[model samples]
Target chain A: MFPSGHPERSAVERNGVEGSRDQTLKVPQRYSSTPLRSVRNDEKVSRHSSLCGLALGLVLIACAIPSAKAQDFLDHVDEALSFSALNGEVRARVSGTLDLEVYHFSGLSPGLIRTTNDTLFNPRLSLFLDAQLGPSVYLFTQTRVDRGFDPSDRGAQLRLDEYAVRVTPWEDGRFTLQAGQFSTVVGNWVPRHLSWENPFVNAPLPYENVTAIGDKSAPYYSFLGIGTPAEKYEHNPIIWGPSYATGVSVAGKIGQFDYAGEIKNASLSSRPESWPITRMDFANPTVSGRVGFRPNEMWTFGFSASEGAYLRPEAMSTLPFGRDPGDYHERLFGQDIGFAWHHWQLWAEFFEARFEVPGFTDADTFAYYLEAKYKFTPQFFGAVRWNQQFFGDVTNSYGGTAPWGRDLWRADLAVGYRFTAHTQLKLQYSFQHEKDGGNDSDHIFAAQFTVRF
Target chain B: MRCLVFCLCLLSALTRSAPAQGSVEGQVDLPRTKSAPVMTKRYEIVTTGGVLGTNPPLAVVYLEGSFPTSSNLPTKQVAQKDLAFVPALLPVQVGTKVEFPNLEKDTYHNIFSYSPAKRFDLGRYRPDEKPVPSQIFDVAGLVTLRCDIHEHMRGLILVLATPHFVVTDDSGHFRLKGLPAGHYTLKAWIDSRTTREHPIDLKSGSTLQVDFPATP
Candidate 1:
């Protein structure tokens, strides 16, 4: 429901449908006359069911031909035929990185510190498949794989992420919905890296450490529960353009700015009976919103914020049928700012988080990164970065780190180069120090390669 | 009749070809990339910023310029190559003659323009062959150009009175030359999807450099 006298409606009405919404193609599917297409094959054993399946199959074939063409190719009749319509594109990317670090403790002098080097060269791969079903409906899917650190080594049963479905009912696609698993709409940087289309290597602290499930967290960091459940709604915006929201999202435009907000339930935890599996839930319902402005064709800006209580699975109880209680809540707040010129880019972000424990002191943390880049060539650029992290209230954890409350600091210097369109290489060196005034510091080094298709 | 022939001959002597067709060249500068270089046989670079390629030549380029728009109705024009339509952007006036020079060595080509503004199709013809003299664009507006055989070959016939446009070069530079002595609206188009416009007054031989910024 939209608020009365909301400023965005008029903006949408005036500016027409937003461009982003218009271009996004949906995934394709055969809508069977049987209605319930998900039924198992064994269920169609009866003669009546067999007849129904055959009739449904015939109807689907009739509907599928034209529908797929319209939806996928914007109703281009010439491209509707299998021989006439080429319905796929080859999307790929390649990227790499290097990280170096020097460690020092608060009590130890810089001379006594030694460097513990770590390097990574993981290749990222992706495949995006798109097809049109009709003038108003289409289908698309992107599957990705990575090779570097064994996810199972990191306690993950499966390493892959992202299998999503989207639908557009309207011809112009001003209003649309997306269903299926997708990247959490929590932050800008966590979903996709700058090298893939972003401007920086590290996400703002709030985004890097909060809600997102990956290596960018502390020993007690949160993981993506199972999936973000719910449908996302987006309306064409007027001025700044289209905005996206999920989990009961409201999107559209207001005057010269585009805005979006969503309220959704995130998984907190899950545990199996008679098994050692204790899945954590970040499944609590949370709210997030973003507003963007575009004054002219060249300049654009956006601001986003979110707050949610993430469930901690490690705190789960082994009880057999009793309800498990949620005992920890992490509050996140952050801001992002970015700008792009013809050949130059600037981005900076700051975030602060507070982890609330039922029986322990509240742990607070802050992280920030500032970076600027210039495109020396279409595929090459140089940049300087400053990144810092502060962790406070380190308690002891089973993983060998102080519990939720520990204090530490890190500073880094980085330079990056891109050799080809998708291939990139980055080298970074950072210095980290402990706060307790004791001498425990080590050096860190990392290198990574990312490829997308 | 003899006096009319003498007058026509004198007029023909005075007429000359449109200014030897000079080229407009420029470069596009992109911000440095942060990660390792992407390795591919050929990199298809696209950004919120934009990429450059001619509808006809199909050469890859980086560009920064005004986006083309259909707000102000212009005459429809079409460019054809092979059986494919080229230059995708065809800014012409109503009743303008669009020459379809067949660049393909073997196939026949047919050009068609279908839109609310104009609708007409030129029957097929072999290479080095000509379609009925020319198709007259009687309507003013955006027209979609297509070929019968090559489904991917598509272009727009932007019929207009003023030709205030330029395409970005390999380096992303564009310049509109030889403007009429008056104030006019300048618009740039990319892929017929994104467009930007501005009002400017130019001297007959002045060159203006307009830099289009990549969306952040």
Candidate 2:
């Protein structure tokens, strides 16, 4: 659909045969001499002329409305006239990383299959486009193309990670409104989760390991065979909070406090095939927001929350006809803190999630991570991160079979050398352990090089 | 020979009919703090007290009035070398044109300023390319110069309406000479601090002594 006030055109028709004929082409002598034939030709010419005029008029209207609207908008919001010049600014940037890793997993026991131990290479490329449309309006989009060495999967995948239009109608950007698909504002790390911005190779547990409903592909859930009783007690995790969502957000800073809120599509039941929230089948929608306080330059603390229905489409369809969908709601709460002093930087986050599933006992989960980085020199730095997740006990109402909660934790140590502001080399080692009445552990070693222009 | 004789005659005439000019001299007293041990290898310009406590050389002293007529100074040049501005801070009269030339042969630089006094961006250009036009600072305020390509490179331009200004030396002493005897407002400024102003009266043929308390 076209924007408001734009000229709407359904279709335009032309007499293809007559329009394509040359002016020099003449009618048959018998028809040319007939008054009726001449009259018909004249009518056709008149009709064609009217169509041409209509087309010209439509084009003129289409071109004039946008410029007039823009001028009017600028006139009303004239405090930032200098920013209007920014409309002429356009920037396209590209950056990515190539990573090589070796993984070794052992100690699989008690109804769990052993994970494969192998070497793999993964490459990611990102493209960013930013443009200013007017003094108070701008557009930004970021896309990523990634390829991993998995013999069973496709060679590569491309995704549009973020596309947003931001408008600052007030002076000094004191108030902003953004609409479109964008990264969630639940935590600080999600905004800077790119390979170049992140200090470590992998994301925190809450962001990477949160098991969504019906997500059989999750590493932790892979052990549950199809049609197994354990599969019926799927629980929601905080992972969906950081994924991109299609919605509108309002964000601004008032004094030392900053706040943002968004209403987006409902959470996904499984990992999206291409992008997050491609469809919102249910009437339920998610609400996510964050509020932060920065009393000084070195420290900030924030609180975030999300609530909505997270049931898969198929699961929702199977519910009783009169059952209220709101009964299967998912809720999450998180707290984050960041501090930077001289050469040291510290970040931490804690998350708690609750899910209400039909025909099963409700589930609750908890996750948190702490990371710290020290700059040894202007170009070299070392970082360490610890992430852990604990799942709630699940009970099957039909069979009365319950599984105890599982706990997983990982520790990562990494060092990076930046050859320039736009290039870096990093090496990282990680150890992961899981405790759920079974033995599960893994070790990972990785190296990555990233460059940007 | 003609030029030499003209210069000598002019010198004698100026000496005979020279005005009785007064001078203002002042010492900036900075509070001393604990000093670090001498380093074997110094990377930055580390003063005895470092940047936080008591570096007096960072202050700029100037007189604000029309006692001395402002003159159009020649265009100044700030060179970009080793990813740093040669002179980190510079004070100049209003209407001065400043040229930023990249001295690194292999790299390109983009100089820009978003200061309220003046806003401009000279897009990226190579060192060997033809010289770009100089940026004119016509307003009276501080214009911060930066390189968009090199985030760490920073330069400051203090554009003042008055012509009489001097940076304090290492010894914390500054002298502004050739001032016609009159009452004027003396001002001292340090980075990220308030401006200190004092009313001073000067007599002809006399040197006035002023002491400016150091900023915390």
Candidate 3:
């Protein structure tokens, strides 16, 4: 991966380097680009909200039956009941998590955007329904209602983010086949992305930072350095958070090695509206996979790669005639490692992606983060993460190759305390700065209260 | 009639052997029901049950008043095996030195408790290490022990003020005998949050019958 101003810019391009542009101060239009696109985005949000309501309603109905005497039927399901009348094998359990978060970050800086209120607060809920059929088959789904799990979410809207069903052939979980809409398998963060698991409020730079590459249309590259930047915040990153694209996956643990592979309809950076199969097709499905090695219970290392079409079908008119959009794709490679010893837990990951923006040369970028958590006490803990993102070279409008975006790094410090086994409160503060920009307004303060039931 | 007369004579003689001490025996009225999940677990793999765990829903019965125990007592143990503390629930007298040994074949364990009764953090140790880690619980309160790594792993050490204590059997029955004649408070501890106590006048050589979850 090229580290910004490398002399061999053309060589990095040949080897698939990707560049990105970010504007933390610029406002992100929830529905971006032209006015027509914005209107469509609004409609899409309403449609998704309705769909989420229906799905959650179905999940609730499954927990009860129609009967005049069944007023409190669902609440009584604290224990799984195997009904002989129904083959005596069906047992179901419903559990959930509620997260209330408050965040305040300066929007008047070189980086730090995303809020309608000076002090913003929101509540997110995640419900899990698991039902076992006999000894080998099971059905499980996770439904979430969230207005951007964190402050990084562009707009304030609550919707279902993910749902999946998993199957295992044997009692021992050495093999599993999962289907439905689920998260990507390319990184180490997906497993602990939930509020109750992750200690931080904001995503890593790779997932949150916007690249000059846009999914809706041709990308706009900046001039040499950060001059003459893109006019709008219509850009994408190497990945937009945990890519919960609809797909099928197979994962298993054998001996000390674990492996997983996924085939999804949309690429990692596709917006939430395009995640559903009805909006996108598998003509050029994204294929991503990961292989991990665990020498022991204390340490794990993984390598992952993915290549797929990141452009949306609506952007077809923006490209030259007779060109297939899939030819210009997003290719990514990553490495992650985790170790837990005694009271210390550590994790680090490095990712580089190359986006072939239609008409323009490929954009190359790299992102990384190293985090460590210490258990200061049984009920309290402290964690810190060092994160940064750098862009390679891109041919600008003036016919010269230079970094298409600015580079930046951030340090996040967080502390958490568990009031009880089921409830915990986390507070975090971050210091961020661009390579040439000041950090006067780049400070971030956030807090989250999560309860699992 | 002759057999009944013989049984009465045997009971009378047994009472004379411990004339200076009283006893209490009872059955707890906690109904036998399936135990709900300890916490709301997300989509996870199958649970690998603990190697050593709590036996049936047992209760700890003890006297509540101060009763100084003898010094130079043996240190109690709560070993970490299969990523869990053996004997998930433990009851001990105040000042009992509790040892936490890592017994897993692989992986390390760090045993620590934030309970107000005994706040101690035994640093991490590899499996089967020499000299087990321990803490002498001097306070009379519930000490909840947990592994710093494995969040699901849990154990409890209930420290009592008096030396008279016994754990209930599978059928919820317990007997605490050989208590010096005195005015004492009898109590039952079901869990850290659930306990019932009642003042009692225990006379010499008398056996008092008690039942709980029935007005204390």
Candidate 4:
């Protein structure tokens, strides 16, 4: 579901191109910056180009042949030409998916806010390239191109979502070491967050919400009981399980048990503003890991943990309240389970995080979500999800007006139809309720189409 | 002189009559469940009495130990259309070759197998493209064929060394004729399960009958 690597293509190419049967063509290297007169005078370049063109033409002719044997011969030629271009090495395989979504949101809150109702469109295109450099070494990169028509979001951008180099010292992939920017192995959903894989349009509370409240352009409203002063909102603690961080990870499987450990530059709460501008704090590294066991194909259970600094020492010192920067550590623990039987799939996760605040006592927050999907038929499926976040009472806070411990819950219902193996359409409706004086709530409806190739 | 003529005639008759050939006939009892009706109505199991048959044609009956003298067999083809394998199940000799051709237009297909008998991948290819060179089944075992892009597309290949084989008809009846009279270990395979071997001795010009119990 996470867009598994395709070793099949390489296997076929390897088998189809016999070593003794293929003839390698010598390709010439030409620099476009060279003078035009110099290029025209180069005999070797002209001959190489002509030979390559001739080979292409021959391949086309071979394909047009009606006989199966002749077509096979032409296929070999095409493969050989491609092989030669890659130096007889099939190093990389490429795959990608496209997802587009249209959604409308309506909110009811205590304050007089403009644009209580809004509609927007979001589109995301992702490409994955996995290169097997050697039998034991591999490189993988994922790039995402996105466009968001929201006033408060980044308009359009192309970002390198994940880039990692993995080294498998063992032959059977029982042990692996990966380095670079990659998804945090804290929970089950983040790794499978693609639109086609996820049953719902939006992520659960633990991954989507509970981030630094002040990071967005919008102002923080105490519609929920938990409130933070506008000046100190930047330090608000939220679980950042869905984000990717620059780090090195070690992962492998032993029988039915799988484990992954990561040492990242920053905690989930402190993800960089953007992937391109990521900056690591070498002195304060975050360690996160998950250990899971699949008793059988039908069920999987996992436990995850992370401990690191959520706020930078410099940023902690500039807080409005008298707080110590050294005491701001974030520790998180979680348990997750997945079950699949017949046409039904269920997944649930519970997360509890303890944050050490400078001016206040440690704030403990609990977040969890349960989701279930049933496939009435192979092509149609219906799903429902319930998610909530509860903030523990805060003590020794400088300001009593802050919504110290607010609670929020959301419910989602969705139905999806798969037109083909590579295409799907999903419609989802969700409602969010905040338990506070104002009882703020929001209604959201979304439709998404995803295609993979 | 009459006795000498008679002896010559007897010798000529013996030479003309080669080793006697026998036939093996059998009926396979397929396991049926009350739930089968629901599955059939859902189109999960086609009742076409062939590749996706519920009984009879679903099983492959063959003899072990004895083989044909010739090893040269023409290549066979399995095509992809309507998002399904033309023949969901195929049986061939150990050294036979199989070709998978995509017949759909403007679509891509990939064929692969991880069975220990034959592990290979044809990669993703377009329609009308040359099929991967015929896959040679050198090992005698079941090879599960699957499409990586389409999870539901599945096919099976049964490679055996013996040349005496037959697939049961709609009535669950099968007959293998023209087999040289001898002792043989008869086996029947249905889906992924195989029936116990029934050893039998065939007398000259005689018919042998064997039946396999239904499997759950």
Give the candidate number with the greatest TM-score: 3
What's the distance in Å from true for residue B120, model 1?
Answer: 39
Error of 3 at A177 (Å): 2.1
Displacement of residue A256 (Cα, Å) in model 4 is: 3.3
Query: Across residues A19-69, which tens digit of lDDT does each residue of candidate 3 receive?
Result: 423312221222222332233566657755654564455334323322212
lDDT for A161 in candidate 2 is: 70
Report the TM-score for the A-chain of model 2.
0.69
Estimate, for each residue in B2-104, the C-alpha lDDT of model 1 and write its tens digit: 9999999877775433322322333334333212111111111000111112222211121222333344443232445433456655666455666666565
Cα lDDT of model 2 by residue, B107-166, tens digit: 456676655677666655556556644788889887767664454355778888887888
For all the predictions, what are the DockQ values? 0.03, 0.03, 0.14, 0.03
| Shift in Å, residue A164, candidate 1 | 2.5
Give each prediction's root-mean-square deviation over alpha carbons: 24.5, 24.5, 10.6, 22.9
Displacement of the residue A211 alpha carbon in candidate 3, Å = 1.7
lDDT of 1: 0.37
**Which pairs of residues have clashing backbones in candidate 3?**
A17-A364, A18-A363, A18-A364, A18-A365, A19-A363, A19-A364
Candidate 4 retains true contacts at a fraction of: 0.00
The per-model lDDT (C-alpha) reads: 0.37, 0.57, 0.67, 0.60
Q: After superposition, how far is residue A407 of candidate 2 from its true place, in Å?
A: 1.1
Better of 1 and 2 by lDDT: 2
Q: What is the number of residue pairs that collide in model 2?
A: 0
Clashes of 3: 6
Model 1 segments more than 4 A misplaced? A1-117, A130-140, A147-160, A167-176, A190-195, A198-250, A263-283, A294-303, A312-314, A318-327, A391-412, A437-443, A449-453, B1-216
